[model samples]
Target: MVLGGDFNTSRPELLAPIAQIARECDGRSYAPGDASQEVTHYTYVTAPGPAYGTYTSSKLDYLYSTDDFTGCDSWTQKADQADYRATTVPTGVSDHAPLYGYTCGGPRLSWDMHGSVDGVVADCSAYDNNGSTLGAVEWSAADGGAAVFGGTGHLATPTPPVDSRLSLSVTAWVKIAANAPTGAIAALDGSRISGFILWYEADGATWRFGMPVADADGWNVDRVIPTVPAVAGKWTHLVATYDAVSGQMALYADGALLGTAQHTSVWKAAGAFTVGRDLVNGRPNAFFHGSIRDVRLYDYPLAPAQAADPTL
Candidate 1:
Protein backbone atom coordinates (compact mmCIF):
# COMPACT_ATOMS: atom_id res chain seq x y z
CA MET A 1 0.00 0.00 0.00
CA VAL A 2 1.12 3.61 -0.64
CA LEU A 3 0.27 6.56 1.63
CA GLY A 4 1.26 10.23 1.70
CA GLY A 5 0.31 13.50 3.39
CA ASP A 6 1.39 15.76 6.26
CA PHE A 7 1.95 13.24 9.08
CA ASN A 8 2.60 16.43 11.23
CA THR A 9 4.79 15.27 14.12
CA SER A 10 7.98 13.31 14.59
CA ARG A 11 7.54 12.54 18.27
CA PRO A 12 7.79 8.88 19.20
CA GLU A 13 4.53 8.94 21.19
CA LEU A 14 2.47 10.08 18.22
CA LEU A 15 4.45 7.88 15.83
CA ALA A 16 3.82 4.73 17.89
CA PRO A 17 0.63 3.72 16.07
CA ILE A 18 2.24 4.22 12.65
CA ALA A 19 5.19 2.23 13.92
CA GLN A 20 3.00 -0.67 15.01
CA ILE A 21 1.22 -0.77 11.68
CA ALA A 22 4.51 -0.70 9.77
CA ARG A 23 5.79 -3.58 11.86
CA GLU A 24 2.66 -5.60 11.15
CA CYS A 25 2.84 -4.96 7.39
CA ASP A 26 6.66 -5.00 7.05
CA GLY A 27 6.79 -1.43 5.68
CA ARG A 28 9.97 0.65 5.50
CA SER A 29 9.96 4.43 5.85
CA TYR A 30 11.71 7.49 4.28
CA ALA A 31 11.44 11.20 5.08
CA PRO A 32 12.86 14.17 3.18
CA GLY A 33 16.51 13.11 2.98
CA ASP A 34 17.77 16.58 3.98
CA ALA A 35 16.62 20.10 4.88
CA SER A 36 17.43 21.28 1.35
CA GLN A 37 15.27 18.47 -0.03
CA GLU A 38 12.41 19.21 2.36
CA VAL A 39 9.43 19.97 0.15
CA THR A 40 7.12 21.60 2.69
CA HIS A 41 7.57 22.20 6.38
CA TYR A 42 5.02 23.51 8.91
CA THR A 43 1.61 22.69 7.48
CA TYR A 44 -0.12 25.43 9.60
CA VAL A 45 1.25 28.97 9.69
CA THR A 46 -1.06 31.99 9.83
CA ALA A 47 -0.05 35.22 8.13
CA PRO A 48 0.33 38.77 9.66
CA GLY A 49 2.46 38.28 12.79
CA PRO A 50 6.06 37.90 14.15
CA ALA A 51 5.62 34.96 16.61
CA TYR A 52 4.28 33.58 13.34
CA GLY A 53 7.91 33.52 12.26
CA THR A 54 8.81 31.58 15.42
CA TYR A 55 6.67 28.67 14.18
CA THR A 56 8.59 28.16 10.97
CA SER A 57 9.63 25.19 8.82
CA SER A 58 9.94 21.39 9.24
CA LYS A 59 9.42 18.38 6.93
CA LEU A 60 5.88 17.42 8.02
CA ASP A 61 4.92 15.36 4.95
CA TYR A 62 5.77 11.67 4.52
CA LEU A 63 5.29 8.44 2.47
CA TYR A 64 5.49 4.82 3.63
CA SER A 65 4.43 1.30 2.57
CA THR A 66 4.48 -2.41 3.38
CA ASP A 67 6.79 -4.81 1.45
CA ASP A 68 7.34 -2.99 -1.85
CA PHE A 69 5.05 -4.42 -4.49
CA THR A 70 6.06 -4.86 -8.18
CA GLY A 71 4.59 -1.65 -9.68
CA CYS A 72 4.93 0.58 -6.60
CA ASP A 73 8.57 1.68 -6.68
CA SER A 74 9.01 5.36 -5.66
CA TRP A 75 7.33 8.61 -4.48
CA THR A 76 8.05 12.35 -4.78
CA GLN A 77 6.86 15.64 -3.28
CA LYS A 78 5.63 18.08 -5.91
CA ALA A 79 6.42 21.65 -4.94
CA ASP A 80 4.31 24.42 -6.43
CA GLN A 81 7.31 26.74 -6.75
CA ALA A 82 10.46 25.30 -8.29
CA ASP A 83 12.79 27.24 -5.94
CA TYR A 84 10.78 26.20 -2.78
CA ARG A 85 9.81 29.79 -1.82
CA ALA A 86 6.15 29.87 -0.60
CA THR A 87 3.63 31.62 -2.84
CA THR A 88 -0.13 31.97 -3.31
CA VAL A 89 -2.38 29.35 -4.90
CA PRO A 90 -5.91 29.18 -6.27
CA THR A 91 -8.86 29.79 -3.95
CA GLY A 92 -9.61 27.16 -1.28
CA VAL A 93 -6.15 25.65 -1.72
CA SER A 94 -3.56 24.84 0.93
CA ASP A 95 0.06 26.03 0.82
CA HIS A 96 1.53 22.61 1.60
CA ALA A 97 2.94 20.80 -1.44
CA PRO A 98 1.16 17.72 -2.78
CA LEU A 99 2.67 14.20 -2.68
CA TYR A 100 2.61 11.95 -5.75
CA GLY A 101 3.61 8.28 -5.93
CA TYR A 102 3.19 5.02 -7.86
CA THR A 103 1.76 1.84 -6.32
CA CYS A 104 1.58 -1.81 -7.55
CA GLY A 105 -1.83 -3.16 -6.69
CA GLY A 106 -3.59 -5.59 -9.05
CA PRO A 107 -6.13 -4.43 -11.61
CA ARG A 108 -9.01 -2.66 -9.87
CA LEU A 109 -12.24 -4.57 -9.18
CA SER A 110 -15.77 -3.27 -8.87
CA TRP A 111 -19.13 -4.26 -7.39
CA ASP A 112 -22.22 -2.69 -5.80
CA MET A 113 -23.84 -3.24 -2.42
CA HIS A 114 -26.42 -1.47 -0.27
CA GLY A 115 -26.39 -0.31 3.33
CA SER A 116 -28.62 1.80 5.60
CA VAL A 117 -28.19 5.58 5.77
CA ASP A 118 -30.94 7.11 7.93
CA GLY A 119 -32.60 3.70 7.59
CA VAL A 120 -32.68 3.99 3.79
CA VAL A 121 -30.69 1.57 1.65
CA ALA A 122 -27.69 3.10 -0.11
CA ASP A 123 -25.25 1.63 -2.61
CA CYS A 124 -21.75 1.27 -1.15
CA SER A 125 -19.49 -1.19 0.59
CA ALA A 126 -15.94 -1.83 1.92
CA TYR A 127 -14.44 -2.04 -1.59
CA ASP A 128 -15.51 1.44 -2.65
CA ASN A 129 -12.60 3.23 -0.93
CA ASN A 130 -8.89 2.35 -1.31
CA GLY A 131 -6.48 2.39 1.63
CA SER A 132 -3.07 3.80 2.66
CA THR A 133 -0.63 3.85 5.59
CA LEU A 134 0.53 6.88 7.61
CA GLY A 135 3.26 6.92 10.22
CA ALA A 136 1.38 4.48 12.47
CA VAL A 137 -2.13 4.46 11.04
CA GLU A 138 -2.91 1.81 8.38
CA TRP A 139 -6.25 2.75 6.80
CA SER A 140 -8.09 0.42 4.41
CA ALA A 141 -11.76 0.13 3.58
CA ALA A 142 -11.33 -3.12 1.66
CA ASP A 143 -10.01 -4.99 4.68
CA GLY A 144 -13.63 -5.67 5.66
CA GLY A 145 -14.13 -2.26 7.35
CA ALA A 146 -13.90 1.45 6.72
CA ALA A 147 -10.61 2.33 8.51
CA VAL A 148 -8.73 0.69 11.30
CA PHE A 149 -5.77 2.15 13.31
CA GLY A 150 -3.24 -0.26 14.69
CA GLY A 151 -3.89 -0.32 18.44
CA THR A 152 -4.61 2.78 20.54
CA GLY A 153 -2.06 5.47 19.73
CA HIS A 154 -0.87 9.05 20.27
CA LEU A 155 0.14 12.05 18.04
CA ALA A 156 2.09 15.22 18.63
CA THR A 157 1.68 18.63 16.92
CA PRO A 158 -0.31 17.26 13.98
CA THR A 159 -1.54 20.32 12.05
CA PRO A 160 -3.61 20.60 8.90
CA PRO A 161 -2.22 22.06 5.67
CA VAL A 162 -1.50 25.79 5.54
CA ASP A 163 -4.27 27.85 3.90
CA SER A 164 -6.82 25.22 4.95
CA ARG A 165 -9.49 26.96 7.02
CA LEU A 166 -11.75 24.45 8.80
CA SER A 167 -14.97 25.90 10.11
CA LEU A 168 -17.37 23.06 10.82
CA SER A 169 -19.44 21.15 13.33
CA VAL A 170 -18.00 17.80 14.43
CA THR A 171 -19.98 14.76 15.58
CA ALA A 172 -18.39 11.52 16.66
CA TRP A 173 -20.02 8.13 17.34
CA VAL A 174 -17.52 6.62 19.72
CA LYS A 175 -17.28 3.31 21.54
CA ILE A 176 -14.65 3.45 24.23
CA ALA A 177 -13.10 -0.03 24.64
CA ALA A 178 -10.47 1.26 27.05
CA ASN A 179 -10.67 4.09 29.53
CA ALA A 180 -8.74 7.11 28.21
CA PRO A 181 -5.87 8.73 30.06
CA THR A 182 -6.04 12.05 31.88
CA GLY A 183 -5.71 15.16 29.69
CA ALA A 184 -6.85 13.38 26.54
CA ILE A 185 -7.75 16.13 24.05
CA ALA A 186 -9.76 15.16 20.93
CA ALA A 187 -9.77 18.52 19.23
CA LEU A 188 -7.62 20.84 17.12
CA ASP A 189 -4.49 22.60 18.40
CA GLY A 190 -1.22 24.25 17.26
CA SER A 191 -2.91 26.58 14.78
CA ARG A 192 -3.38 30.32 14.87
CA ILE A 193 -7.12 29.73 14.57
CA SER A 194 -6.98 26.64 16.72
CA GLY A 195 -9.87 24.26 16.07
CA PHE A 196 -12.13 22.78 18.71
CA ILE A 197 -10.88 20.06 21.11
CA LEU A 198 -12.73 17.76 23.61
CA TRP A 199 -10.93 16.22 26.53
CA TYR A 200 -11.75 14.02 29.54
CA GLU A 201 -9.75 13.22 32.64
CA ALA A 202 -9.96 9.58 33.71
CA ASP A 203 -9.38 10.41 37.37
CA GLY A 204 -12.64 12.33 37.80
CA ALA A 205 -14.43 11.52 34.58
CA THR A 206 -14.74 15.26 34.18
CA TRP A 207 -14.95 16.52 30.62
CA ARG A 208 -13.96 19.95 29.38
CA PHE A 209 -13.93 21.92 26.12
CA GLY A 210 -10.65 23.77 25.35
CA MET A 211 -10.50 26.79 23.05
CA PRO A 212 -7.91 29.43 22.33
CA VAL A 213 -7.58 32.67 24.29
CA ALA A 214 -6.61 35.90 22.53
CA ASP A 215 -3.33 36.43 24.36
CA ALA A 216 -0.72 33.79 25.21
CA ASP A 217 -0.83 31.80 28.49
CA GLY A 218 -4.57 32.12 28.60
CA TRP A 219 -7.21 29.47 27.83
CA ASN A 220 -10.96 29.91 28.22
CA VAL A 221 -12.66 26.96 29.87
CA ASP A 222 -16.31 25.95 29.48
CA ARG A 223 -18.23 24.28 32.26
CA VAL A 224 -17.31 20.63 32.73
CA ILE A 225 -19.61 18.05 31.14
CA PRO A 226 -19.49 15.03 33.34
CA THR A 227 -19.26 11.66 31.62
CA VAL A 228 -21.94 9.05 32.24
CA PRO A 229 -21.05 6.73 35.08
CA ALA A 230 -18.38 4.45 33.63
CA VAL A 231 -19.61 1.26 32.03
CA ALA A 232 -16.97 -1.19 30.84
CA GLY A 233 -18.36 -1.41 27.28
CA LYS A 234 -20.62 1.31 25.92
CA TRP A 235 -21.07 3.72 23.03
CA THR A 236 -21.60 7.47 23.40
CA HIS A 237 -22.06 10.60 21.35
CA LEU A 238 -19.74 13.41 22.41
CA VAL A 239 -20.32 16.72 20.66
CA ALA A 240 -18.77 20.21 20.81
CA THR A 241 -19.23 23.57 19.05
CA TYR A 242 -17.41 26.85 18.43
CA ASP A 243 -19.12 30.04 17.25
CA ALA A 244 -16.41 31.99 15.42
CA VAL A 245 -17.64 35.41 16.45
CA SER A 246 -18.63 34.81 20.05
CA GLY A 247 -15.68 32.59 20.88
CA GLN A 248 -18.26 30.57 22.81
CA MET A 249 -17.75 26.86 23.33
CA ALA A 250 -20.31 24.21 24.30
CA LEU A 251 -20.42 20.48 24.93
CA TYR A 252 -23.22 17.92 24.79
CA ALA A 253 -23.81 14.23 25.30
CA ASP A 254 -26.69 12.18 23.90
CA GLY A 255 -28.56 15.44 23.20
CA ALA A 256 -28.25 17.10 26.60
CA LEU A 257 -26.33 20.34 27.16
CA LEU A 258 -23.42 19.80 29.46
CA GLY A 259 -21.43 23.06 29.79
CA THR A 260 -20.40 26.32 28.12
CA ALA A 261 -17.56 28.86 28.19
CA GLN A 262 -16.85 32.25 26.65
CA HIS A 263 -13.65 33.49 25.11
CA THR A 264 -12.60 36.91 23.82
CA SER A 265 -11.58 35.44 20.44
CA VAL A 266 -11.90 32.20 18.55
CA TRP A 267 -8.97 30.02 17.50
CA LYS A 268 -6.41 31.43 15.06
CA ALA A 269 -6.98 29.96 11.60
CA ALA A 270 -3.51 28.83 10.46
CA GLY A 271 -1.82 25.75 11.96
CA ALA A 272 -2.03 21.97 11.98
CA PHE A 273 -5.23 20.33 13.24
CA THR A 274 -4.84 17.19 15.28
CA VAL A 275 -7.05 14.34 16.46
CA GLY A 276 -6.65 12.14 19.60
CA ARG A 277 -3.82 14.30 21.03
CA ASP A 278 -2.45 17.81 21.59
CA LEU A 279 0.26 19.67 19.65
CA VAL A 280 2.19 21.18 22.55
CA ASN A 281 5.85 21.51 23.58
CA GLY A 282 6.69 20.98 19.89
CA ARG A 283 5.31 17.40 19.92
CA PRO A 284 2.11 15.33 20.43
CA ASN A 285 1.18 13.47 23.62
CA ALA A 286 -1.91 12.37 25.62
CA PHE A 287 -3.12 9.80 23.06
CA PHE A 288 -6.60 8.24 23.06
CA HIS A 289 -7.20 4.50 22.54
CA GLY A 290 -10.82 3.85 21.52
CA SER A 291 -13.07 3.21 18.56
CA ILE A 292 -14.08 6.43 16.78
CA ARG A 293 -16.45 6.47 13.80
CA ASP A 294 -18.62 8.86 11.79
CA VAL A 295 -16.33 11.74 12.72
CA ARG A 296 -17.97 14.75 11.01
CA LEU A 297 -16.88 18.40 11.03
CA TYR A 298 -19.12 21.34 10.09
CA ASP A 299 -18.24 24.97 9.47
CA TYR A 300 -21.04 26.20 11.71
CA PRO A 301 -22.22 25.31 15.17
CA LEU A 302 -24.94 22.66 15.27
CA ALA A 303 -28.24 23.33 16.98
CA PRO A 304 -29.18 21.27 20.03
CA ALA A 305 -32.07 19.53 18.29
CA GLN A 306 -29.97 18.80 15.22
CA ALA A 307 -27.15 17.40 17.32
CA ALA A 308 -29.54 15.25 19.37
CA ASP A 309 -31.47 13.72 16.50
CA PRO A 310 -30.70 9.97 16.59
CA THR A 311 -31.20 9.61 12.87
CA LEU A 312 -28.23 11.86 12.14
Candidate 2:
Protein backbone atom coordinates (compact mmCIF):
# COMPACT_ATOMS: atom_id res chain seq x y z
CA MET A 1 0.00 0.00 0.00
CA VAL A 2 3.04 2.26 0.05
CA LEU A 3 5.57 3.17 -2.66
CA GLY A 4 8.72 5.20 -2.14
CA GLY A 5 12.11 5.95 -3.75
CA ASP A 6 14.19 8.48 -5.57
CA PHE A 7 12.94 8.87 -9.13
CA ASN A 8 16.05 11.01 -10.07
CA THR A 9 13.72 13.43 -11.86
CA SER A 10 11.38 16.20 -10.73
CA ARG A 11 9.67 16.90 -14.02
CA PRO A 12 5.93 16.41 -14.17
CA GLU A 13 6.14 14.38 -17.35
CA LEU A 14 8.55 11.81 -15.87
CA LEU A 15 6.36 11.25 -12.77
CA ALA A 16 3.24 10.60 -14.79
CA PRO A 17 3.36 6.89 -14.03
CA ILE A 18 2.90 7.41 -10.28
CA ALA A 19 0.24 9.99 -10.90
CA GLN A 20 -1.51 7.59 -13.21
CA ILE A 21 -1.36 4.87 -10.57
CA ALA A 22 -2.80 7.24 -8.04
CA ARG A 23 -5.70 8.04 -10.27
CA GLU A 24 -6.35 4.45 -11.30
CA CYS A 25 -5.80 2.73 -7.94
CA ASP A 26 -7.04 5.39 -5.48
CA GLY A 27 -3.50 6.15 -4.25
CA ARG A 28 -1.99 9.56 -3.47
CA SER A 29 1.48 11.08 -3.24
CA TYR A 30 2.75 12.21 0.20
CA ALA A 31 5.12 15.13 0.15
CA PRO A 32 6.17 16.56 3.50
CA GLY A 33 4.41 19.92 3.42
CA ASP A 34 2.27 19.49 0.32
CA ALA A 35 -0.51 17.23 -0.89
CA SER A 36 -0.54 17.86 -4.62
CA GLN A 37 3.05 17.08 -5.66
CA GLU A 38 6.34 15.46 -4.61
CA VAL A 39 8.51 18.15 -3.01
CA THR A 40 11.54 16.73 -1.21
CA HIS A 41 14.43 18.97 -2.20
CA TYR A 42 17.42 17.74 -4.19
CA THR A 43 20.23 18.93 -1.91
CA TYR A 44 22.92 16.75 -3.49
CA VAL A 45 26.05 18.54 -4.63
CA THR A 46 28.17 17.05 -7.37
CA ALA A 47 31.40 18.02 -5.52
CA PRO A 48 33.30 16.84 -2.45
CA GLY A 49 35.76 17.94 0.30
CA PRO A 50 33.82 20.79 1.98
CA ALA A 51 32.94 22.33 -1.34
CA TYR A 52 29.89 24.55 -1.49
CA GLY A 53 29.18 23.56 -5.03
CA THR A 54 25.98 24.10 -6.96
CA TYR A 55 23.20 22.18 -5.22
CA THR A 56 20.18 20.82 -6.97
CA SER A 57 16.95 22.55 -5.97
CA SER A 58 14.11 20.41 -7.17
CA LYS A 59 12.01 17.48 -5.93
CA LEU A 60 13.75 14.14 -6.62
CA ASP A 61 12.37 11.78 -3.97
CA TYR A 62 8.77 10.68 -3.40
CA LEU A 63 6.30 8.42 -1.59
CA TYR A 64 2.78 7.29 -2.44
CA SER A 65 0.21 5.45 -0.35
CA THR A 66 -3.05 3.73 -1.13
CA ASP A 67 -4.05 3.89 2.53
CA ASP A 68 -5.60 7.06 3.89
CA PHE A 69 -3.36 9.26 6.05
CA THR A 70 -3.56 12.71 7.61
CA GLY A 71 -0.65 14.98 8.53
CA CYS A 72 2.77 14.74 6.92
CA ASP A 73 6.26 15.35 8.40
CA SER A 74 9.68 15.89 6.86
CA TRP A 75 12.96 14.59 8.30
CA THR A 76 14.55 18.00 8.53
CA GLN A 77 15.17 19.03 12.13
CA LYS A 78 17.06 17.20 14.84
CA ALA A 79 19.01 14.03 15.57
CA ASP A 80 15.54 12.76 16.62
CA GLN A 81 12.05 14.21 17.24
CA ALA A 82 8.49 13.51 18.37
CA ASP A 83 7.15 16.06 15.84
CA TYR A 84 8.37 17.65 12.61
CA ARG A 85 10.97 20.39 12.69
CA ALA A 86 10.26 23.77 11.15
CA THR A 87 13.20 23.64 8.77
CA THR A 88 14.25 21.20 6.05
CA VAL A 89 17.49 19.19 5.66
CA PRO A 90 18.36 18.60 9.30
CA THR A 91 22.05 19.31 9.97
CA GLY A 92 23.04 17.80 6.62
CA VAL A 93 22.22 14.26 7.65
CA SER A 94 21.61 13.39 4.02
CA ASP A 95 21.74 15.00 0.62
CA HIS A 96 17.99 14.74 0.35
CA ALA A 97 15.58 15.06 3.27
CA PRO A 98 13.06 12.24 3.87
CA LEU A 99 9.29 12.74 3.57
CA TYR A 100 6.63 10.88 5.53
CA GLY A 101 3.09 11.24 6.90
CA TYR A 102 0.95 9.63 9.60
CA THR A 103 -2.44 7.95 9.58
CA CYS A 104 -4.27 10.63 11.57
CA GLY A 105 -6.79 13.39 11.02
CA GLY A 106 -5.99 16.92 9.94
CA PRO A 107 -4.45 19.33 12.44
CA ARG A 108 -6.69 21.76 14.27
CA LEU A 109 -4.29 24.20 15.94
CA SER A 110 -0.61 25.10 16.39
CA TRP A 111 1.75 27.78 17.75
CA ASP A 112 5.21 28.01 16.23
CA MET A 113 6.27 30.46 19.02
CA HIS A 114 8.52 32.40 16.70
CA GLY A 115 6.54 35.64 16.92
CA SER A 116 6.74 38.67 19.20
CA VAL A 117 6.08 38.16 22.92
CA ASP A 118 5.47 41.81 23.79
CA GLY A 119 2.09 41.68 22.03
CA VAL A 120 -0.43 38.89 21.31
CA VAL A 121 1.31 35.61 20.38
CA ALA A 122 -0.06 34.78 16.94
CA ASP A 123 -1.52 31.38 16.21
CA CYS A 124 0.18 29.89 13.12
CA SER A 125 -2.70 27.51 12.45
CA ALA A 126 -5.79 28.40 10.39
CA TYR A 127 -7.98 28.85 13.45
CA ASP A 128 -6.81 32.47 13.87
CA ASN A 129 -7.31 32.14 17.64
CA ASN A 130 -4.33 34.11 18.89
CA GLY A 131 -2.64 33.58 22.28
CA SER A 132 -1.82 35.88 25.18
CA THR A 133 0.92 35.70 27.78
CA LEU A 134 0.15 35.00 31.43
CA GLY A 135 2.33 36.30 34.29
CA ALA A 136 5.84 37.50 33.43
CA VAL A 137 6.71 35.03 30.71
CA GLU A 138 9.62 36.30 28.62
CA TRP A 139 10.86 35.15 25.22
CA SER A 140 14.01 33.11 24.76
CA ALA A 141 16.16 33.04 21.64
CA ALA A 142 16.02 29.25 21.50
CA ASP A 143 14.09 27.68 18.63
CA GLY A 144 13.60 31.13 17.09
CA GLY A 145 12.24 32.86 20.18
CA ALA A 146 10.44 30.44 22.49
CA ALA A 147 8.31 31.37 25.50
CA VAL A 148 10.20 30.92 28.76
CA PHE A 149 8.16 29.96 31.83
CA GLY A 150 9.63 30.84 35.24
CA GLY A 151 7.45 28.86 37.61
CA THR A 152 4.27 30.91 36.91
CA GLY A 153 4.21 31.99 33.29
CA HIS A 154 2.55 30.55 30.14
CA LEU A 155 0.64 31.21 26.90
CA ALA A 156 -3.12 30.92 26.82
CA THR A 157 -5.76 30.91 24.11
CA PRO A 158 -9.15 32.52 24.49
CA THR A 159 -10.94 29.18 23.99
CA PRO A 160 -10.26 25.50 24.27
CA PRO A 161 -8.33 23.90 21.40
CA VAL A 162 -10.18 20.56 21.14
CA ASP A 163 -12.99 18.56 22.73
CA SER A 164 -11.28 16.07 25.03
CA ARG A 165 -14.05 13.56 24.42
CA LEU A 166 -12.49 12.80 21.04
CA SER A 167 -9.11 11.47 20.03
CA LEU A 168 -6.35 14.08 20.34
CA SER A 169 -2.59 14.58 19.96
CA VAL A 170 -0.24 17.28 21.28
CA THR A 171 3.43 18.09 20.62
CA ALA A 172 5.83 20.52 22.29
CA TRP A 173 9.54 21.27 22.45
CA VAL A 174 10.46 21.57 26.11
CA LYS A 175 13.68 22.11 28.08
CA ILE A 176 13.25 22.06 31.82
CA ALA A 177 15.15 24.37 34.12
CA ALA A 178 18.32 22.80 35.38
CA ASN A 179 17.52 23.76 38.96
CA ALA A 180 13.77 23.29 38.91
CA PRO A 181 12.24 20.12 40.36
CA THR A 182 9.18 19.47 38.16
CA GLY A 183 6.49 21.20 36.07
CA ALA A 184 3.63 20.82 33.60
CA ILE A 185 3.97 21.45 29.86
CA ALA A 186 0.48 21.68 28.28
CA ALA A 187 -3.22 21.28 29.08
CA LEU A 188 -6.82 22.21 28.17
CA ASP A 189 -8.53 23.77 31.14
CA GLY A 190 -12.09 23.24 32.42
CA SER A 191 -14.29 24.62 35.18
CA ARG A 192 -13.79 21.58 37.37
CA ILE A 193 -10.74 19.92 35.79
CA SER A 194 -8.38 20.00 32.87
CA GLY A 195 -8.90 17.59 30.01
CA PHE A 196 -5.35 16.15 29.99
CA ILE A 197 -1.96 17.11 31.40
CA LEU A 198 1.47 16.34 29.95
CA TRP A 199 4.03 17.07 32.62
CA TYR A 200 7.31 16.02 34.18
CA GLU A 201 7.08 13.82 37.24
CA ALA A 202 10.06 14.11 39.57
CA ASP A 203 9.36 10.84 41.35
CA GLY A 204 10.89 8.74 38.61
CA ALA A 205 12.23 11.67 36.64
CA THR A 206 9.88 10.64 33.83
CA TRP A 207 7.46 12.37 31.46
CA ARG A 208 3.87 11.58 32.47
CA PHE A 209 0.89 12.14 30.20
CA GLY A 210 -2.26 11.73 32.28
CA MET A 211 -5.98 11.68 31.42
CA PRO A 212 -8.78 11.24 33.89
CA VAL A 213 -11.67 8.94 33.14
CA ALA A 214 -14.36 11.41 34.22
CA ASP A 215 -14.74 15.14 34.76
CA ALA A 216 -15.48 14.74 38.47
CA ASP A 217 -12.86 12.18 39.27
CA GLY A 218 -10.98 10.65 42.15
CA TRP A 219 -7.36 9.53 41.65
CA ASN A 220 -8.25 7.32 38.67
CA VAL A 221 -5.85 8.45 35.94
CA ASP A 222 -4.54 6.29 33.14
CA ARG A 223 -1.10 7.78 33.05
CA VAL A 224 1.43 6.78 30.38
CA ILE A 225 4.78 7.40 32.06
CA PRO A 226 7.64 6.44 29.82
CA THR A 227 10.49 4.45 31.32
CA VAL A 228 13.09 6.87 30.02
CA PRO A 229 14.19 9.68 32.32
CA ALA A 230 14.14 13.25 31.08
CA VAL A 231 17.36 15.16 30.64
CA ALA A 232 17.53 18.80 31.53
CA GLY A 233 19.35 21.74 29.87
CA LYS A 234 18.41 20.46 26.42
CA TRP A 235 15.30 20.60 24.28
CA THR A 236 13.22 17.42 24.26
CA HIS A 237 10.58 16.85 21.64
CA LEU A 238 7.53 15.39 23.39
CA VAL A 239 4.34 14.05 21.83
CA ALA A 240 1.29 12.57 23.58
CA THR A 241 -1.67 11.06 21.77
CA TYR A 242 -5.01 9.59 22.78
CA ASP A 243 -7.12 7.51 20.41
CA ALA A 244 -10.70 7.68 21.62
CA VAL A 245 -11.97 4.81 19.51
CA SER A 246 -9.35 2.39 20.79
CA GLY A 247 -9.35 3.83 24.30
CA GLN A 248 -5.58 3.97 24.23
CA MET A 249 -2.93 6.62 24.84
CA ALA A 250 0.73 6.85 23.80
CA LEU A 251 3.72 8.99 24.63
CA TYR A 252 6.72 9.67 22.44
CA ALA A 253 10.04 11.30 23.28
CA ASP A 254 12.71 12.32 20.82
CA GLY A 255 10.85 10.65 17.91
CA ALA A 256 10.27 7.28 19.59
CA LEU A 257 7.21 5.70 21.21
CA LEU A 258 8.11 5.14 24.86
CA GLY A 259 4.90 3.66 26.22
CA THR A 260 1.12 3.21 25.88
CA ALA A 261 -1.83 2.56 28.20
CA GLN A 262 -5.60 2.17 28.11
CA HIS A 263 -7.49 5.38 28.92
CA THR A 264 -11.04 5.36 27.62
CA SER A 265 -12.68 7.39 30.38
CA VAL A 266 -12.79 10.72 28.57
CA TRP A 267 -14.66 13.96 29.25
CA LYS A 268 -14.77 17.26 27.42
CA ALA A 269 -12.83 19.86 29.40
CA ALA A 270 -14.37 23.15 28.27
CA GLY A 271 -12.10 26.18 28.82
CA ALA A 272 -9.20 28.16 27.44
CA PHE A 273 -6.15 26.28 26.19
CA THR A 274 -2.95 26.92 28.11
CA VAL A 275 0.71 26.10 27.49
CA GLY A 276 3.51 25.98 30.08
CA ARG A 277 0.94 25.56 32.82
CA ASP A 278 -1.73 23.07 33.97
CA LEU A 279 -5.06 23.35 35.81
CA VAL A 280 -5.76 20.72 38.40
CA ASN A 281 -9.05 20.57 40.38
CA GLY A 282 -10.16 23.79 38.66
CA ARG A 283 -7.12 25.63 40.06
CA PRO A 284 -3.75 26.72 38.80
CA ASN A 285 -0.98 24.19 39.44
CA ALA A 286 2.24 22.70 37.96
CA PHE A 287 3.55 25.87 36.35
CA PHE A 288 6.25 24.88 33.88
CA HIS A 289 9.73 26.10 34.64
CA GLY A 290 11.46 26.08 31.28
CA SER A 291 11.27 27.17 27.65
CA ILE A 292 8.56 25.78 25.34
CA ARG A 293 8.36 26.17 21.58
CA ASP A 294 6.58 24.85 18.47
CA VAL A 295 3.52 23.67 20.42
CA ARG A 296 0.97 21.83 18.23
CA LEU A 297 -2.45 20.27 18.76
CA TYR A 298 -4.12 17.77 16.46
CA ASP A 299 -7.73 16.60 16.64
CA TYR A 300 -6.78 13.04 15.69
CA PRO A 301 -4.43 10.48 17.15
CA LEU A 302 -1.09 10.01 15.36
CA ALA A 303 0.15 6.60 14.29
CA PRO A 304 3.50 5.14 15.38
CA ALA A 305 5.27 6.03 12.10
CA GLN A 306 4.04 9.61 11.98
CA ALA A 307 5.58 10.12 15.41
CA ALA A 308 8.85 8.16 15.36
CA ASP A 309 10.43 10.42 12.76
CA PRO A 310 14.16 9.74 12.38
CA THR A 311 14.93 13.26 11.10
CA LEU A 312 13.65 15.05 14.19
lDDT of 1 at 193: 27
Flag regions of model 2 displaced more than 4 Å. 1-106, 310-312
In lDDT terms, how accurate is model 1? Answer: 0.44
Model 2 lDDT per residue over 110-151, tens place: 787776546688887777768888787888775677888888
Model 1 error, position 63 (Å): 47
Clashes (backbone N, CA, C under 3 Å), per candidate, total 20, 2
| Structural RMSD, model 1 | 19.6
Model 1 lDDT, residue 88, Cα: 42
lDDT of 1 at 297: 47
Best by lDDT: 2
Q: In order, what is each prediction's RMSD in angstroms? A: 19.6, 17.3
TM-score of each: 0.46, 0.66
Q: Evaluate residue 66 in candidate 2 and report its C-alpha lDDT on the 0 to 100 scale.
A: 60
Query: Which numbered prediction scores highest in TM-score against the true structure?
Result: 2
